[model samples]
Target: MGLDAFAAACCAIPVLASLLAVRFAYVLCRSGLPPTRPRAAGLRCLIVLGSGGHTAEMMNIITELQKDRFTPRYYVAALTDSMSLQKAQVYEKSLIQGEGEKIIKNAQFMQIYRSREVGQSYITSIATTLLAVLHALWLIIRIRPQVIFCNGPGTCIPLCASAFLLKVLGLGWSSIFYIESIARVKKLSLSGLLLYKLRISDQFFVQWTQLQQKYPRAQYAGRLM
Candidate 1:
């Protein structure tokens, strides 16, 4: 084929793939009832705890969850982030002491590699994101939790993508709950934008009413923190 024809064919392939992907995602979203409504106790919870503000916001959301109902909660964070782990430990301790032993005993901390370290180059970030996605895929396969939760964070992108793929393939029943960061007043952060655009999150939550108004598909239940 001519050069122009070859280029057109290549472009057509990706266009077709994109259309198929969007169709598959839409089918997955409409396949069954919503995933957030837990029907039984001991629902395994996998939470992605991003560093800094993301961690604090997720902690607040976790507090709203019934500690007794969601058993064996797993917190996933980036390997380079020690602060988020520390905060998670404190929260786990509180859950144990206040709610029961399940929180302390069953709660696990999963540290995946950072998708983008401080001052990393764009190429390096892309490489690390691929690695993070692999790790996230394996982690999700291993745990196969009923639900996965995360707020706005770069790290959550890979995990959310993995979960979305899993749902699309019917490989797992894991639902993704992505909450936009409270700091995002005008618009969604990078991670939130990615998840929302791809429709990866089964439940997309926003902290501000304006955000919800902007993105009608997202749910807004007031301030999480």
Candidate 2:
């Protein structure tokens, strides 16, 4: 009787895992649909900012966002990226000036550790990457944002992965939108490639028509910058 129960449990494990995987895949497939209207409280949004040009382009895109709908915005950047945070703060300040105290109360900024620094040894990067992912998971759980917006940034990889995990576990449903950098005319950035190949992003956009042709899943939005 004990041997039979053990065998049954072993068989059940794989079956349960397979069902979870199927459910997760269905969720991913359905993610592309337009989200329903938010509650009267509004939707929480998480925006991941990269360094330099990446930040500039993202700011441009976000500037057009309806501040009232995507309320309680959370801006995330790399721990080492003070400049990007500063830029985001500046943008928030502009919002405050235009929209008043409500905008000030609705904005939040956060920083996450980078997975792998440039020139870091790959051996060491593995450990650092794991740490980053763990930190990202904690942040995602804490925020539980309804929408996640990011462009070409390595910093976003961990956050998006954490959000996807939450979705699979039936913990949260953070819609992830990945926009390729405007500079990537011929190919997707490494970060973009990973998200694209993994199908982790609910919506993927590219500026170049060539990239759209090459990646049918990516929508061509023209030069956003």
Q: Judging by lDDT against the true structure, name the best candidate.
A: 2
Candidate 2 lDDT, tens digit per residue, 1-225?
999999999999999999898988878777888767647777899999998899999999999899898988999999999999888888888765556534477889999999999899999999999999999999999999899999988999999999999989889989899999999999999999999999999999999999999999999998897
Off by over 4 Å in 1: 1-27, 35-39, 98-103
TM-score of each: 0.82, 0.92
Best by TM-score: 2
Please report how far candidate 2 places residue 21 from its true position, in Å. Answer: 1.9
Question: Which digits, one per residue and each the tens of the lDDT, describe model 1 over residues 1-225?
Answer: 699999999999998888778868665656335645647668788989887888988898888898777778899899988899889888888755456545477789989987888899998788888888899899888888887888887778887787767776668777778888889998999889988887777788898999999999898978767
Itemize residue pairs with steric clashes in candidate 2. none
